[model samples]
Target: MNIHLIAVPYDSAVRGWRMGAGPEALLRSGLEDHLRARGHHVATEIVEAPDDGPATEIRTAFVLAAALRDRVRTAREAGALAVVLAGNCGSALGTVAALAEDEPLVVWMDAHGDLNTPETSRSGFLDGMALAILTGHCWAPMAASLLPRPVAEDHVLLVGARDLDAGEQALLADSAIRLVHADAARAECRGCWTPHAR
Candidate 1:
């Protein structure tokens, strides 16, 4: 199998994280080497870092989002599967929404649902609202562009969620992303879900 790695480091609309170094962490952790040993070919594309460090972190986040969308578009044109690891999951959501199709299911693997709209979002940061953006709930133009173009609400699924805000809750009640919280499972279910773990 051939897997393409895409990294989105920041979210203009959300709080920032050490997420910019996620690619470095994975490589240093031997993720690629291990994959190769398993006979899986791995190709990586880093979201080009912006040179505006002294600026507000929010500014840097928007720059990072654009770079990631460009990479994701390139990868999509080439027909490649992707794994986007970033702190602001909401930031890269546009890319994710653009890539989603009815063929393969997209499973948002995370502790937070990442689903909040700007209006519904208590936090103005876009990262917290990624799931909300991707599902086409509410967002800025750029973030909205990355979604399914008049996005379909039924194609999303959320697993391993531990938290969500009030507005996010209201939106979730209206959309199709099914959230399976962490504590709702028994040991047997957890064991069964391990293979699909993700």
Candidate 2:
């Protein structure tokens, strides 16, 4: 398979700090060579925000998302499996926008429920609102700017989420999005799982 590895090396829209270093670290660890050893052809691209670009997290995220959208679309057109290495979950908005078609099934694996909107977010972490943006619950304009369509809530499956904020928990309880607890996921893989309330 041909793999297009696009790296978004920014965390909180800022460059050269924190999680932003993750992409380079992964590359330095020989991710490309490992994939080649496994017989997959790899192409790489790195997304960098302008030094003088928007300083706010949300604004910077949108900028990165737009760039990612174009790159992901190009990879798809070239018949390559686009693999995005991103510093934060917010980069997923661009990925989903570029790839989603006819109600795509989103299997999100994470330790925390990234379902908080700006209104419900107590920590003010913009990455927490990524899923909300993808589903069009918040940041509609920003989301639409990248991709006009919103992924359906029923088609999203949240797996391995063990930590959730109060607002996120409340929202999940009232929403149609499916949840698979970490324990349940592990048990199911081992063929010893049973149905239970999330």
Model 2 RMSD in angstroms: 4.7
lDDT by residue for model 1 (59-123), tens: 55556666676777677677776667665564454465445553335677778777776676676
Per-residue lDDT for 14 in model 2? 79
In angstroms, what RMSD does candidate 1 have relative to the true structure?
4.1
The lDDT for every candidate, in the order shown, is 0.63, 0.88
Candidate 2, backbone clash total: 0
For 97-137, candidate 2 gives per-residue lDDT tens digits of: 78776457898999988999988998889899888888888
Which whole-number lDDT from 0 to 100 does residue 170 have in model 1?
A: 76
Each prediction's TM-score against the native? 0.72, 0.90
Best by TM-score: 2
Clashing pairs in 1: 13-125, 13-126, 14-125, 14-126, 90-130
